[model samples]
Target chain A: MRPVADVLIVLALALVAASSTAAVLARDPVRQSTVLALLGLSLALLFAVLQAPDVALSQLAVGSALTPLMLLLSVRKVRRKGKEGGSHRNAGNRTGSTDQEGRR
Target chain B: MNGWLSAAALLLLVGFAPTVWGAASGPVRRRVMAQNLATLAGCLVLLLLAQGYARPSYVDLALVLAVLGPAGTLVYARLLADELAERPARDPVARALGRAMTPLAAVCVPLVVLPLCVATGPGRAMVKLLAIGALLIGGNIVSTRALSARHATGHTPRGTGHTPQATGPERHTTGGQSGAAGG
Candidate 1:
C-alpha cells in the first residue's frame, strides 16, 4: 500500500511539473489558460493522492475552472479595448490632419 | 497495492498524460478538447482513488468535478467562440476525437463504474457512483457538441447582438436537463 501510494504521488508530482512548465511555455494567453486548467487538474489529483480531499475539492473549483475563466475573460476584454483604442487613435489622427489643413 | 489503486495509476499514465500533451501543444480546438478530456480523466481518477482509499467521502471530489468539468469547457467554448470560428478544428485528429467522444464515454463509464458499484454493493453510495457516471457521460456529450465546428460556424455569423448570450443560456438549459435526467 505504501509503495502504491508513493507511486501515485510521484506520478502526480511529475504531472504537476510538466504541466506547469507547459503552461509557462505556452505563448498564447488562450493556450496558456487551457494549460493552466490542466495544471489545476493535475494539482488536484496530487492532493487527492496525498489524502487531502478537502484541499483537492477547493483546488478543483478554483484552479480548474475559476482561474481559467478569469484569464480568458481578461484576455477578451483587453483585446476588445486594444481594438477600440486603435480605431479611436486612427480617427483622432484623421481629425487632427484635417484641422491642420483648415488652419493653413 | 490494491487493484483500484493500480488501475488509477495506469489511467493517470495512459489516459491523463496524453491529454496533458494534447492540451499543451495543439490548435485551439484540440487544446480545448484535450482540456475537456483531462477533466473526465481527473474525475474518474478521483473516483478510483475514493474506492482505493476506502473513504467514500472522497467521492465528493469526483462528483464536484463531474459538474464543473463540462461547465469549464463550456466557458472556453463561449469565450473562445471567435477564435474557434476563425480557425476551426478540421484536422483528422480533432475530428477523430470528436467522433470518438460518445463511444469512448459509453465504454469507459460502464467499465469503471460497474465494477466499483459491485464492490460498493447496492446502497446510496452505489447510487451516487452511478449518478457520477451519468454526469460524466452527459457532460462529455454536451461539451463535445458545444466544441464542434458545425456548432461554431452556426453561431459565428450572429456573433454580435444577443446571439452569443442566448446560445450560452440555451446550452446551459440543455445541460441542466441532462443533469436532471442523469440524477
Candidate 2:
C-alpha cells in the first residue's frame, strides 16, 4: 500500500476475504453464522475506513446482531420442525397397515 | 500508517485472525465465544482506526459494534441454549475455554477502550465514547454472566442455577446435550 489508509483498507479486505472463505466452507449454519459475523465486522471497518459511515452503520446493525440472530432462529426452528416431523412419521408408520386395509 | 493505524493493523493481524480461526473451525460453544471475542477485538480496531484516521465520526461504527456485539452473543446464548444444553460438561476443553477467556475479555476490552477515551479528549465525542465503552463492557458482563449461568446449570446439573433454566424456556433455558461438541 502506498500510504497508511491503503494499508488499513487492505488489511480489512484480507480479514473479510479470510472470514468469508471460512463462512463459505462451513456447512453448519451455526458455525457459519459466527464466521459471517466476523466477516460483517471486517466489512464494516472497511466501509468506515473508506469514508462510508452510512454504510458502516447499517452494516454494523445488520451484520453484528441481526444476521446471526436470524441464522440461529432459523436453525432452531428447523431443528424443532425436524423433531416434529420425526414424531409424525413414526405415528404414520404405526397406522400404515390399517390405512392400507381401509383403502382396500 | 501512524501509531493509531499501526495499532489497528497490528490488532487485526494478531487479534482477529485467531478469533476467525476459532470461530470457523471449533465446536459451536467455542465458536460462540470466538464470535464474542471478535466483537470485542473488532470494536478496539474500529476505535483505533477512528483515532488513526482522525475521523471522530468513525467512532460511530465502534459505538454500534459495542452495542450490538454482546447483544448478538446473548441472542446466540439464548437461542442456542437448547442445542448447547444438550452437550454435557464432560469436555474439559470447553470448560477451560470458558474459564480462561471470560476474564481475559472482561479485562482486555476496557483496557483497549480506556485509552481511546483519553485520546478522544473531553467533548461530546468523549462522552459518547465513554458511553460506548460502558455499554460494551456492561453488555459483555451481562452476557458473560448469562453464559456462565447456562453452563453452570447445564453442565453441573446439580447446581442451583439449574432450576430456573428448567422452569423458564423462553428467556434463559438450557438443556443437557452431551453428544455434540466441546469446541
Candidate 3:
C-alpha cells in the first residue's frame, strides 16, 4: 500500500507538471485556460488519494469550481474584445481605401 | 493501493496535458487562469503528501490555500481589467512595487532557510515553505501586471466603472461623448 501510495504521488505530480506546462505553453488562450481548469480538477483527485478529505474538498471547490469559472469569465471577456476588434479591422479596411484614393 | 492511486494519477494526467500546451505559448489573460489550474494540481499533490505523512498541518495549509485561491484570482482579474481600461500612462508606484518583489523574495529566503535548517533538517517542511512562497508571489505578480496592463490599454469591459446606468451602444456614445467633453 505504501509503495502504491508513492507511485500515485509521483503520477499526480507528473500530471500537475504536464498540465501546468500546457497552460503556460498553449497558443490559444481559451484552450490554455480550459486546460488549466482540468489541471485543477486532477489536483483535487490527487488530494483525495493523499487521504486528506478536507483538502480534497477544498480543491474541488476552489480549483475545479471557482478557478475554472474565473478562467471562463476571462476567456469570455477576451473573446468579446476580439470580436469587437474584428469589426474594427473591417471598418479600417473601408476607411483605408478612401485614404488611399485621397493620397493619390 | 494501486487502485485509487491509478485512477487519481490518470485523471491528473488527463487534466494537465492541455495546460502545459497552453503555457508554452505567450502569456495572456487566460494564461494566468491556466497557471492557477496548474497551481491547484500542485496543491493536490501537496495534500497527498500530507496524507501520506499523516500531517494535520499540511491539510490546514491546503484549506487555507483553497479559500485564498479564488479570492486571489478574482482580485488579479479585477486588476487586469483596470490595467486594460486605463491609458498607457504608467504609474511610478506600481513600477516600484513590481521591483520590490524580487528583493522581498531574497529577504524571505534567508528567513525561511535559517529556521528550516535548524528544526526539520532537509525535508518536507522546506518544500512546503517553497510552495507557499511561490503561490503568494505568483498571485501578487499576476495581479499587479494585470492592473498595469489594463491601465495602459484602456480596454476593459464596459460597465466596470461607476457611472449612471446607461444601456446599449447608444449609452457608450453618450457616455464617451460626455467623458471626452468633460476631459
Candidate 4:
C-alpha cells in the first residue's frame, strides 16, 4: 500500500508539473488556462492520496468550479475586443513574434 | 502534522506561480479560472490536512481562503476589463505604488511565518490568520496594479484563437501588454 501510494503521489506530481509547464509554454491563453485547470485537478488527486479528504473535497469544488468560470469570463472579454490586425498577413506576423519574444 | 501540511503548502505555492505568471501572455479568463482552480486545490489540501489533524478551526480558515481567492481574482478581472476598454496609461503614482508594495509584501511573508514557531492553541489560529491575510491582501494589491496597466495598454487579451495572420511581429510589446492586463 505504501508503495502504491508513493507511485500515485509521484504520478500525480508528474502530471501537475507537466501540465504546469504546458500552461506556461502554451501561447494560446485559453489552452494555457485549460492546462492550468488540469494541473489543479492533478493537485487535488495528490491531496487525496495524501489522505486529506476534506482538502480533496474543497479542491474539487473550488478548483473545478470557480476558477474555470473566471477564465471563461476573461476569454469572453478578449473575444469581444475583436481581432486586432484583422487582415491575414499582418495577423500572422503579429502572433508569431508576439509568441516567441513574449515567452520568457 | 507540520511536515505534511508544510509540504502541501509548498506544493500549493508551486502550483500558483505558473498560473499567475501565465496570465501575461495566456488567456485572461482562463488564467483567472486556473488561478481559482489552483487556489481551490491548495485550500482543499490544507483542509484535508486539517481534517486529518482534527482541527476544525483550520478548516474554517481554508474555507475563507478558498472563497476569497477566486472572488478577489474575479473582482480584479472586472477591474482589468474596465481598464482595458479605456487606456489609463500608468503614471508615476502607479509605478511608485507597485515598487513600494512589492518589497513590503515580500517582507511580510517571513513575518507571517515567524508566528508559527511558537504557535499553540488559539495562538496558532492567529498565525494562520495573519499569513492568509497577507497573501490575500498582497495578491489583491498586485493584481489591481497589473489590471490597471493592462487596461491602459490594451495588452493581454484572453482569446487563444489568434490566427498567425491576425498577429504581427511587433506584437511582442503587445504580447507583454496582454500578459499584464489582468485584474
Largest TM-score belongs to which candidate? Answer: 1
Regions of model 3 farther than 4 Å from truth: A85-104, B1-183
Error of 3 at B126 (Å): 41
* Candidate 2 lDDT by residue in tens digits, B53-159: 88888888888888899899888889877545645444454566566655666687678777877887788988888787777666665666566666655655434
User: lDDT (0-100) at residue B174 of candidate 1?
Assistant: 59
By descending DockQ, how would the candidates be arranged? 2, 1, 3, 4
State residue A29's C-alpha deviation in candidate 2, in Å.
Answer: 1.7
lDDT of 3 at B71: 54
**TM-score of each model, in listed order:** 0.83, 0.79, 0.34, 0.32
Write model 1 residue lDDT over B17-82, tens digit each, in one string: 889998998778788889888998889999999999999999999999999999999999889886
How well does candidate 1 score on lDDT at residue A10? 98
User: How do the residues B1-183 of candidate 4 rate in per-residue lDDT, one tens digit apiece?
Assistant: 444455444454564444444432333443443454345445545544454354556555454654465454555456435333332223333334334433433453334334332343456565565455455445544454444345433533333244454345435644563354222
Docking class of 3: incorrect
What's the lDDT for candidate 4?
A: 0.50
lDDT of 3 at B118: 45
Q: Which ten residues in a row have the lowest lDDT in candidate 3 chain B?
A: B82-91
Off by over 4 Å in 4: A1-30, A37-41, A52-104, B1-28, B52-120, B155-183
Q: Which pairs of residues collide in candidate 2?
A: B30-B183, B85-B175, B85-B176, B85-B177, B86-B176, B86-B177, B86-B178, B87-B177, B88-B178
Clashes of 3: 30
> lDDT per prediction?
0.84, 0.75, 0.49, 0.50
Q: Is candidate 2 or candidate 3 better by TM-score?
A: 2
Q: How does residue B59 of candidate 3 score in lDDT?
A: 49
